[model samples]
Target: MAIKGSGSPMEAVDEYFDMLIKSRFIEMFGDIKTNSKGWKCHKLGELGSFKTGGTPSSKHEEYYQGTIPFISTPALGPNYIDDSAAKYHISKEAIENCATTLIPAGSLIIGTRINVGQSSINKIPMCTNQDIVSMMDIDKKYDLLFLKHCLNQYIPYLDSQKKGATIKGITVELLKSVMIPEPPIDEQKQYVDFVEQVDKSKAVCK
Candidate 1:
């Protein structure tokens, strides 16, 4: 069915839910860039250990023959993803010999290059290309989903920080220096729960 204005029915539904989520997010966190809620702020790097990803040499055909998912900046999605999200696979031998390292499941993968601020949570252990960085061993005081939403709000700021003569990208130092407001753990959980409900509603729209 056609909507009253522009866009198809699906597009209108998606935009409606997008606005709902954004409005609720702003109501809960205020302006994240200015810490408008008067919450204590912490540098993002302080919350976790970060590992820069690396690509294995492609000359070795054997490297691609294994089952481990190899993610890259292009595969860093808007939400949680699993091994199937990636198009490439790497072998165990590739890890032993290549610069790529295995990041644990549930770690957040961020696109430092190309897309600049795109990110996702990996639901399975995987390796990534040089353009991505994985945030692992996060502090327990914060919920993972809470941190993800905070980072999502920083996309515009992060995009502005990208620098390069060719392939523009954000540096680990820049990511580390970026600060985010930290609400109480219970409050963070509540927001995450709210987001989850919104996501379910979005899925129904899809």
Candidate 2:
């Protein structure tokens, strides 16, 4: 059966699941308070390396028209990502010089400059423009999905701390200092699994 919103029950379910996940997340982590200097803090560069992306010089004919997915800040939407609708592409040569560091599938891509903490996990290997920050799991100890949730939790605070007048931005240092609860990997996976199941159930209900 289908529901009214977004023309499909699945869409309605997805929206409901998103809210449920957020609420559950706060219930799980909201009370474990920490002082500003007490939590285990590390700079983003220390945890994982990141690099900016570039535009394949449009003047050159060979710079584009290939299978590589080129993503920009605007592509990171509210809930879903539309990879097929990406705006640009690059040749093997452009990939070599411009976006050499390929963001592996499932890694979190964060927008640091304008939007601050907006992030999404790429389901396929892709490259991003300068405005995005791709974070790979350095030690496999942290769940990528959990980290994404943590980032989402911190967005409002990060936005409030923006120092730039004309162009607000968060430095690598600031991002790193943002504390995250270091739960066991198994527990993290369980949380993710539970959320996924809730999403599935919502879909069925709708």
Candidate 3:
């Protein structure tokens, strides 16, 4: 998979490690489509609760004036996101007025529209726009990082299945029905540890 970029040295380095990490995921869990390893499969809906957020009405000028971080898809980082990652902020009244919910810190924020499959674990409680859905109160049996990677593995397929000719997106039902292999808790932890080591290397590169 060739990643197109300006070909600067820094960009090249990042791309190399990014590809390396992707290849490592494939090594750990063969093709997710076939479940070649025969791990137990479970629908994502069975693993947690899903909440889709809403955008505050732009008609109200006061809605965007408060301290609460209003995270949208662009703010989602590869693994974790904090207040600093967000570009917009809103007031509590915005939450009350809009259909959005106050997603607690540590919840997994997954993009549903436009940039479907992009996700991150929020390090601060935040509100999101209509384009994002969050997984909250995740089942205790599954490791959050492991589940994040599992969702990421489905990105290619999700991208292909996206609807909308203008602002491509996937439905919440599709995201809920997506199946992922469920390895034992210990194995999931082991994968997380490996990821930490690789991330340390990525940090060094930076």
Candidate 4:
């Protein structure tokens, strides 16, 4: 796969990592992707493993309050999770008995059901419930925030899948199948900077 620069703003809004030829896009859709750049594309599963978290048994009331933060689907935000944001905490004993898993800080976590598209990069080690999935041990070459955005970018497709009483939200198999853009770290940094600048500008306008 070829490493690509983030290219112009033209490359930013591509459909879930589909790097169409800039010229072809212009010829077909007209001049919009004039600066679109090619980027390496990969399935989310190929980049890292998705670990679904487990919830501690409620029967064990002792696990309800402790020092270790316990993350739930509600804790997930669209992009960032703070170290102080977890609403529940668990005890070491509950972790042992209940077999909850703790992913490291910097891992990108996303909710799989209920509020489906919620996502964020956890700032500390924490355990999430079964309703969420974490990209544990993400490949070092990709930026965490960048990956979150890429995943978030794929959310609409996830939502478009038919829902029913049996399957109301994103499933692991579906989530794993989405293709994502893999730009060079340098290009990713540029994308990050571009986003920050846009945010700051919005704040100034406010």
Candidate 5:
């Protein structure tokens, strides 16, 4: 028979299967539930330097075709990140004119104002428009993948706390005030490695 929080009898059995995860992965998961008391909190700026990119004037034909990856809002997708699909390309001359900072691979790229917390790691060196925030890990204390996961986890909560009528954005102050669970560096790496493997496996299944 169907049980509470279960869809059907069979589904209830399926749900119970996940209990094995709790038991088997006990070392990886724990309840340190608290009301944001002892966690070390910092603003986004404090975590890394920020850079914004500019769009080359579209009317200029020279900006239309070249080899550089010019990223914009839409390229940041729900799942798989395909960097090759950016709309604009520029020659060396155009690059000098736009002067946008080229982000390196592994840097955490976040959509700051419009999308708030949506983020992805740049798999290649690329440039982005003003709507995004490029974060360079300063002290190497935080893993970019771990930060990305943390951002994804808290985005809904952050969006709910956002205060604005027209723009609906998270302010720099608010972004900075966001709290993160700062476990030891080893623990952070462990969590990131575990999630990365799971993500890779899921992608293969798709």
Candidate 6:
């Protein structure tokens, strides 16, 4: 259907819904100041890849005792994540068998099930359980720190998309299909730099 100017009643209805979707996005992620049309919008999957992890064989006693960090929903913190926070460690044998993907240091993770909307960046390399989704190999064109804050702003939208009457949860497909606004890299860097300075002043490390 032609979007510029709807001619028939049905065409008008389609146009109306299109505008409604964009308008909601504007409301959720404030209108871009410099951009005339608005920020560039991209599906989460287009920007990067998504991976959901799996548990190794629980029956194998050796899989439970190893060096590789096994991340879980309980270990997730708002801003930071320590792999050590994970209760279980997977062995090399488990990694060869059950590992679907490896989440690199500084990559973002969010729980898909019970702890919906909570997110954190891992400080060390690790693998997560099936209940969570992790974004790895994020496109360098976008600032990671900036993307983190944008996701922070986007938590509410994610919550609203949750399905299931008894248990609220999101699927990997749901997360991958979500659309996000992308400000220019330069604009993103400004926000990242500002936050770093703020954290420094607060002595965030201590």
> Candidate 4, residues 115-163: lDDT per residue as tens digits?
6866888877888888888887678778777777666555666777737
| Worst-scoring 10-residue span by lDDT in model 3 | 1-10
* TM-score, per-candidate, Cα-based: 0.93, 0.76, 0.93, 0.75, 0.72, 0.73
- Tens digits of per-residue lDDT for model 1 on 1-206? 33356487777777676567667878988988898888899999999999988888889999999999999887775678897788899999999987789999989888899977788999999999889889999999988988888888888999998899999999988887878788898988988888788879878868
Q: What's the distance in Å from true for residue 40, model 3? A: 0.6
Q: Between 3 and 5, whose TM-score is larger? A: 3
What is the per-residue lDDT of model 5 for residues 127-156, given as tens digits with 9 covering 90 to 100?
777767777764477877666766665677
Candidate 2 structure quality by residue, lDDT tens digits, 1-206: 33356546567667667778888876665622353324354444566666656566667777677777888777773433446636876667877766445678777788777878888878888888777777776547777777777778788887787877787787766777776766678877887887768856875786
lDDT (Cα, 0-100) at 199 in candidate 6: 49
| lDDT of each candidate versus the true structure | 0.85, 0.70, 0.86, 0.69, 0.64, 0.71
lDDT of 4: 0.69
Best first by lDDT, ranked: 3, 1, 6, 2, 4, 5
Q: Which stretches of candidate 2 lie above 4 Å from their native place? A: 1-15, 31-45, 77-82, 163-166, 201-206
Q: Over the stretch 4-59, how does candidate 6's per-residue lDDT look in tens digits?
A: 66787665654555354435435544743323456677777887777888889888
Per-residue lDDT tens digits for candidate 3, residues 157-198, read: 888888897898999999998888988899889888887787
Best by lDDT: 3
lDDT of 4 at 127: 86
Task: Quantify how close model 6 is to the true structure by its C-alpha RMSD in Å.
Answer: 13.0
C-alpha positional error of residue 136 in candidate 3 after TM-score superposition, expressed in Å: 0.7
Q: List the residue pairs that clash in candidate 2.
A: none
Provide the global lDDT of candidate 6 against the true structure.
Answer: 0.71
Clashes of 4: 0
Clashing pairs in 3: none
Candidate 1 TM-score versus the reference: 0.93
Q: Give me the displacement of residue 132 in model 3, in angstroms.
A: 0.7
